[model samples]
Target: MAGGGIDTRVSHRAASYEYKVTRYLIFSCIVGAVGGALFGYDLGVSGGVTSMDDFLVKFFPLVYERKHSHLKETDYCKYDNQILTLFTSSLYFAALVITFAASHLTRKKGRKASIIVGALSFLVGAIINASAQNIAMLIIGRILLGAGIGFGNQAVPLYLSEMSPAKIRGAVNQLFQFTTCAGILVANLINYFTDKVHPHGWRISLGLAALPAILMLIGGIVCPETPNSLVEQGKLEEARRVLKRVRGTDNVEAEFQDLIDASKEAQAVKDPFRNLLKRKYRPQFVIGALCIPAFQQLTGNNSILFYAPVIFQTLGFGSSSSLISSLVSSSALIVGTLVSMALVDRFGRRGFFIEAGSEMIVYMVAVAAVLAKYFGHGEELSIPIAAILVAAIFLFVFAYGRSWGPLGWLVPSELFPLEIRSSAQSVVVCVNMIFTALVAQLFLASLCHLKYGIFLLFACLIVIMCTVVYFFLPETKRVPIEEIYLLFENHWFWKNYVGQRHQDTLAEPEKLGESKPAHA
Candidate 1:
């Protein structure tokens, strides 16, 4: 009877342990999603804020008067383009600075702590922006807001990647992007209703971002620090405890030892930055630093996202119709991103880029062609032409959201080695911000001058991007984080042909030999 009781207690305890680990994993993902939501809200709200009638009247009176005053819309287009650019680009400028700071903070203070700091900065920025009475104050708020975004964006994915099991890492890491789309959708929905709020509607839209920021702060406070980060800090015992809870088993000793080995290998590099200059690391540095950011921004998604309402208005929709159309476009983004989250792990990252890149090139050309034909006819576009323009825009956004939008972040997060991961990612994020700022700064002016030519230019850039993906980008699906270096070292053709097979062989117990047990 006593033996039976002991067996029953053991089974019950095993079930409870499994439940606790699952609960912790879910909660951690939710926390990371909160950070992502903040990023999306910021991106989504700006378009509405800039488009709001009251906001224009209060802050951008000159541009607002192009329609209401004696000047023609085309005549007044030259005015306030620079200032308007400043307003939108300022956040990214601040983000660039914070991306550097985030690297040190993530390394020194731990990922959770950095995220908390970001949340606090974001909350403060939201309050400032909400209460701003002048353009300067608003820009200040945006700067603070950018700082928060920088920290959270860098830390959250790193945290998630460190904690997730290898089999589910892609799906889990994708939660960051998924939540980003959700936040954007939420922001647009809020703006759609608040559009009628008259004097303070834009304020409401910008201010509401505070809610998710606060939630991120609370969540960051409560969640366990990632075991890898703890190992980096030499908190081995604490790391073990975290791994036990997060992994749901006492079998974490092997994983913990792997972390120790990786950390030691990382620490052995005397000067990490200089080491990147070596031949071995240069390719990844170039890919992470230059190619990824170029692909992300040169595609022109930021321009579309930041000026969706304006783009629709340019396509001959009224103010309300433009806002509504932007909402629909954002919805497509959400849906496409959801599909990406489902397939990114299964189909492989490089394949999506190839497929989506081709689609994007096609859609961009179609958009350019339609706009050229319509504008060539006159300022007044027929209903049929306008419908075609909108369709092209939606399809273009759908392809982009599924492909580059999420993978832009995911690929870089997985590509670099552990030693240089934070620093390299920061550099990538900084470059991404710089490109984003450049596009935002130039978008309105380019739209005014280039017209359909701008779309064609982006299409040309996409052709280049697709070529780069085919020749350069490696297939990183389900590749273990520690072995990512091997992917980079192989010739591009080898990675294309035998990379998965190589990874499969490496994953085999006999092939991996001693390390196999650790991974298992």
Candidate 2:
């Protein structure tokens, strides 16, 4: 009788664990990451398009139409440079407003719905940009594109981060950053190949982004809404069903309990945004919504990625050589993102932030010194040394790819509890987009007017970033989302959370004066 009873219990347990991995989750994340690609592609393609005088003349004919009617075609080309600068900068103008709205929209619509909305909006934006007859049309198209990107930017990470197993969360979430680099490489390649053949190649590039948008929309139709969203709607069974598939049965009930607890806390909370200001979560909230993105943009990454070809050209690389270097640089970004994924779970969050931030300071200063010495005023100091300087650009991409690039998203995802994750994510992403726009706008103007002065300014910013990270940042890896609050509530997270085996190297080793294992 005892043997029969044990067998019955085992069979029942196995039966209860039944679940299958669906294709929908994987497909949805890919589709979501594609929106990130469009943002990267558009940013990169504009760099080359901005330099094309003929394309600018054709695209923004209004500027030249009335101002210089009789000038020779060649002379008119020279006079029309002003309009292209304005055209190139229009993207930043649009992104700033759209990102703020994305937070509220995501809160109301849910992740999948917001993504579909963004994709459709992107499709319309691409059509408008492709068919633009005047600068006004172009600006409007840019705004539409910005809206789409804003929605995706906020929605993709939140969905991916939540759905992924915490064990491999960094690896899965890194896809967004990977596709971003891939898009940049694609854009750079298209620009370089079409540079001699088609000045209006930008239209082709802009239209290519629509293909991904369509796929994303289709994917959203097929994928399940996140369990978190389902729960928020009072569909507890539906949430449990989805969780069983994603998380498996080993600890399904326990995991579900945690989810339920988090949901209750979240639902009980009156205003997520206001609650973010509560003393306990406030520091993390500020770090998520402000510090992460600030660290990302202040590293001079935008200055390097967008203006690499220009900087390379100044360093005596032939136009084609500079283009090849951009390809290599983007490839390095992909590789670095992969490396970051490998170490994220191992080294923990704060370690990655501090190490990456400190290293960036070193590289940014070196890049500044190299740019000052090897190239200035559109001239090279010496061809041989300039080649070396051109190669150093890859270092910049690699540094960012490893640290600021992925961590900007990763830190916020890991730092906040389930209740405040979305609110914190929205605020941080909005801050990121705002500063990204500001930095992009200033970077170009600074390059035009300040030359090496931009690099010098970024170098100083990087140093300050390193200081900020070392003093304030907290490490978070392999810890459950709920327990993350313990970091804020407990006085000794480092000592208590970081295991004795890894104590000495931990940032706040003294926190572990008691020296317990990570989980104990």
Candidate 3:
């Protein structure tokens, strides 16, 4: 199903897109990246809210009872109620469905429109969540929040990639992950403080989600549209001006021409989703849209991030200590994103994947082993053992931050050609959200039944996913977004499908890496 002895280690670099990171470029990227914080705030806030005595008592009293009455429940099953889980998972379900609409909006209305829509929807959701009096209102608010996340996630990374120069695409696109981490860290800090605010503390935690939504909304209004999307919309003159402004140079001919060429190819396809099934695109579909997003969740990092406070509480930490622990892990996550941004282009994507995957596997297994040997149901872990577990988790998150955490968004954002970019991103977000929902929905039950075995399962998944990366995924660092197909066409395994029947329908028969005519 893979390489027939074709070398897959080759990495390609195109001539640099003329760029100097001007004010408008930075502003546009910052705005798009801030959208990631909307997502991050929710991720960080939910777990803490769930762990709050006030929230659990209001929405899930049985769970609230279980949390206090340790002897009556097992270590992992304390929060196993599906209704409670649905409070978190329902958002992802909503996000999963809205992704299709976001794809159309991104293509028809431009990426900026989708971001603004997402921000407004998220703000509405946050307000509703803050004022909710019943489970139905809560679920509805979460779904709205998910709608915002779906649209925001679909467009932001693509916006960053399109706006950035090839040389720093990895670093630039990672602004999404960086902001996401910042949101999570900020949320955790807020939760730590809000958790003490008596009966209304949980409402405060959920309500604060509106801050990032407003930030992104403000940023989206002032940021310029991406040159690639502008080109696709046939705004050639305006695209020219934006290109010059963003690049800080008038010599943007090569980059602008490439955008035009890719836009023409994009224009040829009316049904990008249907065209996505063609044999030549099989490689991108399988790797970029499917496997990468799937592997990202199977790494089990999101599951951890989603329930960090709960996981800590289940492991016997006091409520405040659990929030502190989540804060610590999230801090590690931020550090990891910064490291990835600094080193990703220098080291390339593949090396980070394999190396960080190994690191993750080791830590996951260590956590599992420690839990199996030292942690028991209804038992308090010694302070030393508890410290070790937190340390292991911190290191694991650190590894994820540098690897799948950011690359999951970065690689796929740059993987597709302009023609199927929106459609491909839709697939990517849908896969990601569905898996996220599944993990959030089932993790407590899995924890109940599998206990320490859950960590081992993640460790095993890491091994399998890393193997797929080394064998199947090509190195795309420094490759101009439009020229990314070259890496696939030259790859050991992917070349089989990428150069298949799809090329016959194109305007020109130039091999993938060659420059096509701007008019073609």
Candidate 4:
């Protein structure tokens, strides 16, 4: 009868519960979405800023002539391709360093504080980049921006996931992706307008990223902390009040009770770092931290966006024309993210990821083959091939928006036990940022050095990513929040020893379910 009551209660909760998305919740998500915009703006900013030959030649004349300190005015007309590449790619290294450390900082402070730190840093970085008189100062600003990105990358997703209901969790969580595409669009438009309006146009382009940072900082000042974080800190009453405010009075007690259970599990765990190594929690950690985001990067989708101008220009489009084509790809990403918000809950996580990954692998191969054929033959890209390249990039961004982009944030929040959720999630995010930074830096350097071989390298990485997703990642689309504990019970579930372990765990189930998992 008690078990039946629990079932009936869940059904009632599902049937009658109407999420009154409070003003606070909506405001908070919009604020959190700004972080995503900053991400897009920063990535796109470098491509536009560095493309201005006049700006590059003026700002870093030594970049072109290390030996000739006083070159004639006519020397400015010559383009130094290598220095241009360096100017474009330097930001990624800073991103790499910040990503590794953001996890620790978020764990030490709450998500809100960490985000505040990132926002302030981004503001300062933008100023530095805008005022930079030398290449060294510009590099410093990019590093600062990267650190801000690292913090935003970890905190915003954690914030969105904690605040949303399970029914719309996938859609709400994907707000980050949608806003990220929004940021990209904003940056492209800014680039297009600024490039047309001013000779020192790149300064406005670089500085415009500051708007989102300012909004994020102001928003974090008033936003409420995650209920789970509040509960974990033993502020039970405070957690309850927040739940009531965010979730409405329809199920406040049950929600508060769920938070209490999660707090207990969190309290039971002695050490977060060690908890990740334990058999029960390790699988989700690996899947979230290592596998999912890794696959997202290996998709080669970023390569197109990050290097769009150069890549297209190499294929025969003029600088102005390539930026226009890049805008089309950016627009597709926003459209695709909106589609993902609608479908992630309806179609489920497993199908989207597997299908998107498979399709992207084919697109990447075609892109590489086409590029290799043209670049190798010393032939300029014809209109048909250029159109194909643009379409291929569009498909790549579209597929990414639906799959790994948003699920990257959703899975980590859902997969972990309450005890180590924040810390573990932070670690995973940090690792992801580290790799994001590393990949961005290496990609730029590789393009300068390896040329066409760069695509082949990413192609290999994508193959490894495909194998991991097919075998390891589980479907978490409609599973209740509390039930995610099942996926964590055995690290070997992805192995051939699954049925035996299931029997063993079921025979002594009490030890595992002694406490309920947290309400994320």
Clash numbers, per candidate: 0, 3, 0, 0
Over 4 Å off, model 1: 1-21, 67-80, 376-380, 492-520
Pairs of residues at least 3 apart in sequence or in different chains that clash in candidate 4: none
Model 4 segments more than 4 A misplaced: 1-19, 60-109, 376-379, 485-520
For model 1, how does the per-residue alpha-carbon lDDT over 141-226 read when each residue is reduced to its tens digit?
Answer: 99999999989988998888888865567788888888888887788788887888989998999999999999999999999999
Candidate 3 lowest-lDDT run of ten:
1-10
Candidate 3: tens digits of C-alpha lDDT, residues 1-520: 0111111221211354567878987787778667877789899899999999999888889999888876825677788888888989999999999998998899888989999999999999999999999999999999999999988988887788788877766667777889899999999999999999999999999998998899888887778888888887889999999889989999888778867766776677778888777777787889899999999999999888999999999999999999999999999999999999999877878889999999999999999999999876578899999999999999999999999998997888777766677778788888999899999999988988899999999999999999898888877765555556656665667766665323432323233322221112
Model 4 per-residue lDDT tens digits across residues 1-520: 1110113344454554446778767976887688888888887767666655446566756542421223332122223355455555556556556764776666556778778988998999999988888878887888788778877887787778778865666667777778888888888778776766456788889888888899999877789887876776667778778877888664666666655655665566677777676655556777876777666766667767776655665555666887887788888888877877888777767667777777777777777787777653434578888888788878877887778777766666777655676667666665666566555555655654666566677667767776676566665666555455554343245333222234332323333332221211
**How much is 45 displaced in model 3, in angstroms?**
0.7
- Quick one: best TM-score, which candidate? 3
Q: Candidate 2, residue 376: CA error in Å? A: 3.4
Question: In model 2, what is the error at residue 328, expressed in angstroms?
Answer: 2.3
The 0-to-1 C-alpha lDDT of every candidate, in the order given, reads 0.78, 0.65, 0.84, 0.68
State the lDDT of candidate 2 residue by residue for 217-289, as single tens digits. Answer: 7866667777777776678898888887665544466556555655676677677788677665655766676
What's model 3's lDDT at 370?
A: 95
Worst 10 residues of 4 by lDDT: 1-10
Q: What is the C-alpha RMSD of each candidate to the true structure, in Å?
A: 7.8, 7.9, 5.9, 6.3
Q: Residue 221 error for model 4, in Å? A: 1.5
Between prediction 3 and prediction 4, the one with superior lDDT is 3
**Cα lDDT, model 1, residue 234:** 95
**Residue pairs in candidate 1 whose N, alpha carbon or C atoms collide under 3 angstroms:** none
